[model samples]
Target chain A: MSKAEIKSPLPGMFYRRPSPDSAPFKNDGDSVSAADVIGVVEVMKSFHEVTAGIDGKAIRFLVDDADAVMAGQALAEVEA
Target chain B: MVVRVLNPGLSTTVQDLGRPGYFHLGIPIGGAMDRLALRAANLIVGNDEGAAGLEAVFVGPQLEFTRDALIAVTGADMPIKLDGEEKPSWTALKVRAGQVLSFGFLQTGARIYIAIAGGIDVPLALGSRSTYPIGALGGFKGRAIAKDDELPVGNAAGGREGRSIPEALRRRPGMPAELRVLPGLYWHRVTEETHRNFFDDQWKVAPEADRMGYRFRGGRPLQFVERDQPFGAGSDPSNIVDSCYPYGSIQVPGGTEPIILHRDAVSGGGYFMVGTVVSADMDLIGQLQPNTPTRFVKVDMDGALKARADRAALLDRIRSVFA
Candidate 1:
């Protein structure tokens, strides 16, 4: 398998976990797959799920939670 | 197939359902002003619901088809002609290569949509074929149709022989008055008197109105409750916090008049959002021309949902006709 990178489809604030104080959906060294829901992109109180496109392990979280992200902005990198 | 533009009618451009899911990046959904009409026209000629077509305002350009192709027109009542022969609207017609298509003066409504069989071959931007004129992106080179410009027709084929619009469905849309609206997130920021005035008064559309937004005249000024005023009475107390604006959001700056934002509107605003005209009724708003008087009636959330549901059912019925 090859390393995979996850990206946000829309520009919005990224949330690592469901809400503040909640455990992050994935952290470094976590194993994941294409079906995993890595996080969310929230706009105007509406949240959209950001799913991983490839099966891999969470190697790096490129964007911090609640950070504003642009369209096609990179969110994380994973090693499959 | 080729089509020649004789005169680019009032602000003609290729548009579709629009590019959504990118509003957070400050991209406005600059699609067709009348989505239902766009879809209806496309369906008549067997085009996908999201296929790109021509969005004409008030009057339409004189187009001469260079191939025998199927096309349909809907929305406005702009008289249509092919090869100097009067053409019927809301129905598909096959035009020969040498025939010319033209539009007469519009008697009612401001915009009309012309959908060809296979859709237009405009390049897609941000995952859509809709035109976003302000950003200089999408559509035919991301600009309005110009004289002598030739557009390539899509190669998609028509579905069936011919179809007619239901008699009852053929509506001569009346001049819309104040648009009914539901309170938005910032509705409570204004004083009670101001809120009442908004519902009670009639607003005249400003001449400066465009696809971006419509500025209305003759409305009340907003007064914020001291507690509701996030920013205390600073030197510029009129300034409000910027809020995410969906299409049809009415913003009241200084509570004087209301500005109804439509397709091509800015992503966010810093005004008291008094209300949002329901989605179903949004198509009517697109037809309102400058100086038109409109009334705003308030409806509950339930009513809004019911209207949406009704619209969905109507569309579903129309779609089933092809099944």
Candidate 2:
């Protein structure tokens, strides 16, 4: 088994869900594949998708939802 | 020549120097938010200083060149890639037909400018090719670009590739920008404490900022001098009789948040303007990102003129680099 960390490409507010009223894109123990949108980083009022680059089972998020993230910050961990 | 938009990331629009002399007709001088970057992009590609180019916010668009072209990217530190290979910004580069250009995440600044040789060949409106999205006036169909849109490019005017801007001229992100302002037109209405605080405290740019204006928070709530409400004036303490809003006017709607109007702002409004951002620092406002700390510095008319002269000199220095 191997684990990989998802990183944010830009500095902004990280959101687990697509919107405030919607369910999160992925959760702990959920399966994801490369290019599966795991979250979004909202910056300059623009929303950019944060995609999972490796096929894996979601482990746990490293940062809380709606937290401010820096460029290249680790967002979540997944087990492959 | 033509370039096809593959992915219109965020908001991408074509703009030039902008149309002036039409505010009397309620037309805003909609153009590139950062004129300095626009000029840099054009100069790198051997185009006129006011040549039309694409302005991308945050993320940049992916485009496929249909013919050999020379291009330069400027402003923000958004990473550029040609067919997945990294490319340097602020430098002119040659692109072959069928080659795709894409952008990675923005590393610094909030906007990026892409200038191709001979500029983007869109029909001009009102003596300028700048886009006025509110009224759908100019640029490509008078709106932000969409995927699959094929933009016409003009014939190259002898632009050379590999020319780069010196590092000293580039704007570094997170550097606290000191913007010079000329106080006037209802500035006396605010309490002295609030006026002092405006220049003394650090203000963070609000997330709602855009081309129209850059709003600021984290500053002390400004206090207005008590006065009888004039007829037609709104009940808000910050309301004023309808008046013209000059470009870069800083208005406080409710005395809590201050919005500095930009190139795309309305010509007039009914808000109390505390100060006008000097023209020399207008480009700095375009680079401001959400949550960035900014400080306003008060300057007199003489100081403002001096700043403008200093900026012109800097631009000349850059122009002389390739001359």
Candidate 3:
């Protein structure tokens, strides 16, 4: 099966961790379970959590922390 | 059945429920502003909820039915005639071949929904039949109905079943304006006094309103700490991020006139959202025309959720009538 690539549903800045000084959720090739918080999407003042579903390993990070992203922009690739 | 357009009215077009899952492509979810009336008319004629129908605004065109068909009129109480005789509202009626369907002035509400039994035969675009005039992608050439235009109807099922629409599915005559809103993402940005002033004041629907957004007058400009600043896609304090904005988001641009984003609004925007018109009260916004005075009442999250659930149940009840 093809790996599921996760993308941001809205435009906003991408954050590796919920806040600064915190460790990232996953590094390269880090295995993650379904519903794992992959990242956070902050728009205006609202912060929405982006989760990795159905268990997968982070194969690549397509977006950097604090980088502005548009809606539907792919953020990460996950391999089951 | 076929209907010849004597007049197109104001921006009339075929529409379905709406176009979802395309906001990522900057596509606005264009469709019938009054989904309740649209679905009700469709259900009356045994059409699917997603069936294409005519969305007429303010006044509709004079058309002659070329073939016998079943139709229902709902939403605004537009003076309609089955060949010059006045007809009732929110009820299904049979129109014989050659009967001219003409509409008079609107008594209440701005939009009037006309759902044909076989459904307005129109090709689907991006998984929907809604008309997005901005993108010129859906409906008949992605524009409003015009004079002398011949509209095609989905063949068959026009004369097969003549079913009676249950009374429970019928809605009473609607008022000019009454919208319920949930506090927006930036509701707290304005002072509590300003927030109080929002619902307390009466706002008139500006003449500049359209499918894209409804500009309102009378309400004081919502003040913020800074007069002007760079706003990004997201409402975050640091970075302006772009996000898929759903329908009913009240976009306040630089403390300008409050523009209530409607069905044909842009996918994403750069502005401060004061609040959103809750899902239950979306149709109320749809019916507001130029110069209509409307008041915004703040609804709590729980109340908003309950209202949405109630509306869903009501539609479910209407859908079950045929089942």
Candidate 4:
């Protein structure tokens, strides 16, 4: 297995969950597929989905929820 | 010429100088966030200063032109692309009948203005093509452009290619952008400490910044001066009897985060405003990237008028030079 990083295409506050009250799009340590939504980056009030680009497992969140992130910043890591 | 939206990108809408005289009716001006940039793009392409153009944020739209046309891209530092070839921004370029126009990722600012030889031919609602999306009024059926949507372009108005706006005429966000503010009538509501700290702190533009308003964070929470809860004013210390919100008014909803209402500002709101950003500095706010640092500089009536005159002079310069 190998580790891969998921990066955000847009600069904004990264969110683990779709909404404050909802469960996260993907849980920490969950197995993920290439197109699985891991989080969202809210840019200037608009939410854009961030997806895992590779099949992986044991996903570990790198950035905390609601933390400001720059473009191309790594959001999470996954074991492939 | 009609252009087909091949990919509508993030958020692209048609806008002009905006519809005024309707703010009292709860319709905001709702034009391009950066009016100067919009005008520059239009001017560079030989269109009317108030011509309707495409305003894209973060990303740029891909459009295939059905007929030859001249175009100009301005505002953000995004590289323009025509049929996959790189083109310079703020310079008028010609696109063949089949050429597709696109843009690269934003390098500095947040919005880009795309002006064609002729203006976007969307029907005007209440005298303008600016989109007021919240109200479902004006511009390309009153919403953001969508993929596969065919946008009508006005007849060509004899714009020449290769015309460009000079570098000095372009406006960009500053290193720690400064916004001049005029304390509003409600400035008396906040404590003395808040008055000093509000201007003292360097605030960051929150992720929630948008056309409606720009929110700021990392500022100290405010303390309101004790006062009897006037009738109709809510219980929250920051709440006031709903009052007309002036464009650029800085409202503290819960005495915490400050939101500066912009072009699409609501006509009335319950929050208390500490001050309003001077009109001259308002356009630059639209170019600020999220998380960018900003400082509020206090200004009085004389200063505000002087700044307005200076801004108008700059606009006049752009007009004359382009003309």
Q: Which of the numbered candidates is closest to the native, going by highest TM-score?
A: 2
lDDT of each: 0.77, 0.89, 0.75, 0.90
User: Residue by residue across A6-52, what tens digits does model 3's lDDT show?
Assistant: 87643446788977999997776888887888888664245668787
TM-score winner, 1 or 3: 1
Q: Which residue segments of model 2 deviate by more than 4 Å?
A: A7-11, A17-29, A33-37, A40-54, A70-73, B171-174
TM-score attained by model 2: 0.93
Q: Write the per-residue lDDT of candidate 2 for residues B181-234, one digit (tens) a residue.
A: 999879889899888998998988876788989888888899899998799889
Cα error, candidate 2, residue B176 (Å): 1.8
B250-282 in candidate 1: lDDT tens per residue?
Answer: 876666667788888888866657789998878
* Worst ten in a row by lDDT for model 4 chain B: B102-111
* TM-score on alpha carbons, each prediction: 0.75, 0.93, 0.73, 0.92
Worst lDDT run of 10 residues, candidate 1 chain B, spans B228-237
| Per-residue C-alpha lDDT of model 3 across residues B187-236, encoded as one tens digit per residue | 76677777888888888776566788888878887766543335444443
**Between candidates 1 and 3, the lDDT winner:** 1
Please give the TM-score that candidate 1 achieves against the real structure. Answer: 0.75
Give the Å shift of residue B292 in candidate 1.
Answer: 2.2
Which has the better TM-score: candidate 3, or candidate 4?
4
Error of 1 at B108 (Å): 0.8
